[model samples]
Target: MTDLHRRNPYRLPVLLLIALSTVVGLSILWEFRLEAWVMHWLALPYDADFEDAERWRFVLTATGFSLISMLIPTIMLRRLIANTRSSYRRLKQAQAKTETLATYDSLSGLINRRIFMEMVRNQLGLKRPAAVMLIDLDHFKAVNDQHGHAAGDIVLVEIARRLEAIADDNGGVAVRLGGDEFCLLFLKFKHQTELGQIAEAAVFQLSAPLSSAVEPSALGATIGISRSWTDAQDASALLHCADTAMYRGKKDGRSTYNFYDSEYEKQRRAQADLELALRRAVEADEIVPFFQPIVALPSQEVVGFEVLARWPKPDGSTAAPADFIPVLERLGLIPAMTRSLIKQACRAANRWDDHLRLSMNVSAGMVTDALFPDQLLEQLRQEHFAFHRFEVEITEEALVGNLEVARQNLSKLHEHGITVALDDFGIGYSSLYHLTRLSIDKIKIDRSFFEPGQTDHLPMVEAILGMARSLKMQVTAEGVEEFHLPHLPSWLANSGCNYAQGYLYGRPKPASSLFCYTHSSFAQQAG
Candidate 1:
C-alpha cells in the first residue's frame, strides 16, 4: 500500500472516500433503532411504536441518500485531482525541454560552453583534480571550402558522436565549444599520464574520415590538455591554458596534443606579437622583394634573378624569411603579401634586359586560389611585363592541397607563356610524383644534396639530373655556397646542371644592386 501511495500520489482522495462511506453506514444504523433508545434516555420524543419492517425501510432509504450526497463531491474531487496531476506532468516536461535547450548544443547534442563551464566550476569547488582538453580540427576550412558547409556539418556531427561515446566510456563530459572546436572534461583524474591517454584516444577518434555524401577526406585534430591542480584552479584559467597548448600543437604541425607549459605560453605570446607586426608590415608595404642572381653554370654569367621577400624592420635591419614567412602563411597573409611583392617584382623586372628572366616564389595559399593565374596575368599586363621572361617557382609543399587546382593553375600559367619550376626538389616524398604530374619546365635541386660529407646524396643528384635530361627539363643546382672550393663548380657543371644560385655568387640584394651587378658582370665578361 505504501509503494502504491508512493507511485500514485492521488491516493489521498480514495482514502477519504472509504472513510466517508463507513460514516454513512453508521448513520443509517443510528436512524434504524439506536437513535430511538438514545432519545428515550434523554427524555426526548421517539417513534418506538413504528413496525420493524418500516424501520428497516427507513435504514435503506437513509443509506441511499447519504451515498448519493458523498458520490457527487467524491467525483468532483477526483476530477480536480486528476487535472492537477496532468498540469504538474506537463510543467515538468516543459521545464526539461527548456533545460535541454539552455544546456546543450542544438546540432551536436553535446553540452554547450556555458553549461560546460558550470560543470568545471562545480568540480573545482569539490577540490577534485581534473583535466580539461581543447580540441581544434585541423584544415577544417579546407574541408568546408572543398565540400561545402553541409558536408562540413556532417563531419562535425560525426565527430561529436564519437566524442560523446568516448566521454561516456570514461565518465567524462564532452562539449561543443562552437565551430570546429570541442572541449572534454575528465573528472577525478589520478595522473597526467591518464589524461594524456584519453587525449590521444580523442585525437585518434576524431581523425577518422566522416561519413558524408560528398566523399569527405580524412580529418585531423590537435588537442591541448591542462590539469586543474597543475595548470589552473579555475574554469577560465584552465580553458585558457588548454587553448594555449592547443595552438602550440597546431604550430608543431597539428594532429597531436600538447600539455600546458609556461615556456610554451611565453613563446605563443611572442609569436602572437610577430603575427600582429607582420599584418601591419604588409599593410604599410614594409615587405619588399630582394633579387638574387641566378647565374649560368661554368661561365658564371648572370642569366636572371629570383625574387626573395625581406621584411625591413624599423632599425633598417631585415627580418629573416625563415622567421616571418611561416607566420605569414599561418595568418593567411601570404596571398596578399605575394600579390604585393609580385607587382613590385614585375615592375622592376620590366626594366631589365629583354633576354633576362625574373622568377618569383608562389606561396601555397596563392596556388590554391582558383583565380590566381588570371589575377597574376592581369597584374603582369598592367605592368606591361612580358610573360615569356617570367617564371613562378613552387615547392612540393605548395601542392599539398587540391592537386587538381594546382595543376589547373599551372596549366593556365604555361598557356600564357610563363615558365613553372619545381623548387627544393629531393626534400619531399612526392617530388618525383609532382614532377611527373605537373607541367614543370625546371627542377631546382635542394641545398641538402650539396652539403659537404653528404656524398651519399651525389648519386641521387646524378639520378635527378639524368631524369631531368630525359624529360627535356632544365635543372638548377641551388645553394652552391662552396663555389670558391677547387673543382666544386666544375663538378656541378660537368654533372649536367644548367643553372646555379647561391651565396657564392651574392646574397639577395635590392633590385638596384642586382641591376648594377648584372651590368658590371656582363661588361666584364664581354671585355
Candidate 2:
C-alpha cells in the first residue's frame, strides 16, 4: 500500500475503528477508577478519598490511551489485506482475457487453427465419426484484385456471418482457419457423402453477393472433406485425408466439393512420380521443343511457328500439357519450365531464317510478375535472339485474375516488340471483354467448333472470325486433324482466318524432324 492509498477514503473505516476503540477504553477506565475510589473509601476514612480519586483519574487516562493504540493497528492491518485480495481478482481476469484473444480468431470469435486441430485429435477417443471440412474461397484473389483489401475484408466478414447461419444446431462447430479458409467439425457423421452435403450447404450460402464497406462483393468456396470413422483408424490419418480432399477440390475447379478417396490416393502417387520425372527431365535437358507451322494464307508459305512445349521421358513415353501442367502450376515450378522452354525455342527461331517467328506460352502468374518481362528480355538477349521474332501465347483462363497488372505488363511486352496471342479464346470468361482491354495480335479458335458440326456451326465460326478481323487480329484454327486441306483452306480464307495448325499439318515433333520433313517439302514445291 502506497502512502496516497493509505490516505484514501477507504481508510475511513480504520479511522472510525480507532475513534470507537478510544471511547470504549475511556469508559472502561472511568468505571475502573470509580471502583478503585469505592474500594479506598470502604477501607479508609473519607478525608483521604479526594486525593486518591485524582491519582486514579491519571491511571485511567494512561490505560485508555494504551488500549486505543492496540486496536488501531489491528484495524489498519485488516483493511490492507482486503485491498490485496481485490487487486488479485482483477489481475486474474485480465490474464484470462489476454489468453482468449491470443488463441481465438478476432473476426469470427471462433477458435483458431491451433486449437481446432487439437480438438480433432481429442475426438478420436470417442470413436464416433467426426468430419473436418476445409472451406476455401474460390475467387478470393479476384475479389481482392477487383476491389481493394478493405473490400476483401468485408467479404470475409460476410462469410463469417453466413457460417454462423449454416452452423447446425444438432452437432458441429465452425472455425475460421485464417484467411478465407474455414473448418467445420461434425461429431456424429460417419459418411463423407453426408458430410459433403453439409459442407456444400454452408459454402453455398456465400454465393449470393455480399455487401462490403467499399463495394458489393461476391466469393465462392470449395470444400475438402475428411471423416474420422470412415477415413482412418486414427486421428492423423483422418486429417491427412481431409487435407488431401481440400486440394482435390481446388483442382476440380473451385465452387465445388470433393471427398478424398483411396483411388485418388493412387493417382496422387502417380501424379507425384510424373512431376518428379518432369522436373528431372527439365534438369537433364531432356525437354525438347516442337513447332506447329503457322502459314500465311493465300501465300500458303510458313511464316511462323508457335513454339510448343514437349516433355518426353526416358522410357519412350511422352506427357501432355494436361497431364503435367496442373502439377507444375501447383508446385510453382511452371516458371522454371517456361524459362527453359523459352530459351530453347528462341534459339531455334534464331537458327531458322530471319522471317520465321516463334510464339512462347505465358501463364497468368508469370505475366503479372514485375520481374518476369525483364528476366525474359534478359534471356532473349543472352541467347542472341531478337524480341521481334517472338510472340507470346496466353490462355484466357490464364489471364483471368489480376487484369490490370496483366494489361500493363503485357502492354509493356507488346511495346518491346513481343506480339501477344490469346490461346483457347472461347473457352474462358468473356473473351471479347479480354480482347477489348488487352493489346493482342491473334486469337486461336477453340477446336470444338471444328468437330461434327462445321456446317451447322459455320455462322458462329464466321462471327468469331469476323470479331477477330474487326480488331485487326489474325485467327488460328486448332484441331484440324484429318480435315480436307482444300476445303479448310478455302473456307478459312473466306472467313478472314489466315492461320491453321493441327495434326492435319503435323503433330508436335522434334525440330530435326520438322526441318527434315517440312523444309524438304517446301524445297520440292520450289523445285
Candidate 3:
C-alpha cells in the first residue's frame, strides 16, 4: 500500500528467481564444479543433451517455482504476528481485573477488610498517633422493619459511599466489613469523624443530607477508636483492639464514639448485660411513670404536674433518662413506654381536681400513630380530664419534619380541645417560623435562655415574644432556679407569656406532698 511496500512487494521473489536462473545457467556451462555435478546428477546414466533449449527452460522454471513457494509464507506471517500481540494484550487486561477484585469489597466496592488490615500492618512503622475507628449503624434492624429490606440495602450502600469519601485520601482508608458495619483508618485526627475537613469536601456531591434519610435521630453515627499501645504491631491486633473499643461506644449510648479504656471496657461489658436485662424489663412491666408537680411561678401553687418515666431497678437509686432513653429507643420499647404512660397519666388526671392539668412528654411521632389517637381518646373519656387542660410538650427540632402532616394531626387533637405546646422554642433555626404556621397554643422558653452571664439575646427574645403575642400564644419560662430572673413578668405580660414553671417557684414534688401545699396558697395564684 505504501511506496516502500509497493516497491519491494516482489523483492524476495525477484532475488530468489535471479539466484535460481544463475545456478541453472552455471550448471549448463563448462565450469569445473558445475560440469562435474551436472554430468553426475542430470545425465542419469543416459547421454543427455548438454544444452537443450527446452530442457534448459524446464530446469530454470522448476527452480524458480521452488523459490516462489518459500516466498508465499511471508504474507501470512505479518497477520499472525498482529493476532498474537492482540491476544497478549487481552490476557493482561484479565489479569488486572483479577488483581482489582482481590483488594476491593465485592459488596460496597470499597477496600475489603483484608486489604485494610494489610495496609495497616504495612504502614504501622510510620510511627504517629493514628486511630482506627469502627462504626456500626444504630437501629439498623428497625430501619429494615420500617422501610423494608430493599430500602435498608440502599441505606447501607449510601453509607458506604459516604464513609469512602471521608477516608479516600491522605492517611485515611475506609473499609467495608459487610452489613452496616465499617472501619475508618484515621491517618490523622485532624477533624471530627464525618463532619471534619475531609468529609466536608465530599458532602457537596450528595443530593440529600446523608443522615436524615436513614433514621429518626438523623443518621447519627457511633464511633469507637483505639490507639496502638505497642511501639510496633501486626494488623490483626490493631483491628481487634479497635473493634473492641467500638462495641464500648455502642454501649455508651450510640451516636457517639468512645476511645478505648480498660475501666470503661469493663463498664461497657456490664452495660451490655444491663441493656439485655432492660429489654426484658420493658416486657415485664418493670418500667413505670412518676409525676412531679409544675406549680405556678408567683404564687408557688401547684396547678399541674409533669410525668417522668422511671425504671425501678433493684438498686435503691433510679436510672436517669439520659442513661436509658437511647437504650429504650434502640430496643424498640418507645411504643410500649408511650402506651404505658398514656394509660397511667390519664388515670391520675381523672382523680385530680377538675381545675388542675397534666403535662406528659411524648415523642413527636406519637401524635400521628393510628392507635395513639383512639387510645388517648379512650383514656381522656375514662378520666374525664378536660381536653383543654392537658398539654403535650415537644422540642422545636421535632416539629421541623413533616410540618404539614403535623398540622393535620394537631388539628385532630385541637378538635378535642387539647392544648399543644412547643418545648425548647428558641433552639431550632426555624422555630419561630414553625410556631406561627402551626396552630399551637403555647411555647416553652428553653432553659438555656436563663443561664447566668449569657447575653445579647434580647432582640431574639423580644422578637419571639412579639410573634407569640400577635398569635395570642402563651409563653412559659422553664429552669429559673436563681432568685433574680432575667426576663420580667412585664415583658412576658406585654408579650402575652402567662405561665412560669421551674425550681424557683417550687421543686417538682410528688402529688401527695404537693396537694396540701397548693390549695391554701391562693388557689394556684395568677401565673
> Which candidate wins on TM-score?
1
Compared with the true structure, model 3 gives a TM-score of 0.50
List candidate 2 segments past 4 Å from native.
1-76, 94-119, 133-168, 173-184, 189-224, 243-259, 265-286, 291-306, 314-316, 320-339, 345-378, 386-527
TM-score of each: 0.57, 0.54, 0.50
List model 3 lDDT by residue over 36-74, tens digit each: 566688765644444567556766676566556655665
Of the two candidates 1 and 3, the one with more favorable TM-score, higher being better, is 1
Per-candidate total of colliding backbone pairs:
0, 0, 1
Clashes of 2: 0
Q: Give the root-mean-square deviation of each candidate in angstroms.
A: 10.3, 9.5, 14.3
Worst 10 residues of 3 by lDDT: 199-208
Better of 1 and 2 by TM-score: 1
Best by lDDT: 1
What residue pairs clash in candidate 2, if any at all? Answer: none
Model 1 TM-score (2 dp): 0.57
Tell me the lDDT of model 2 at 152.
Answer: 78
| Model 2, CA-based lDDT | 0.75
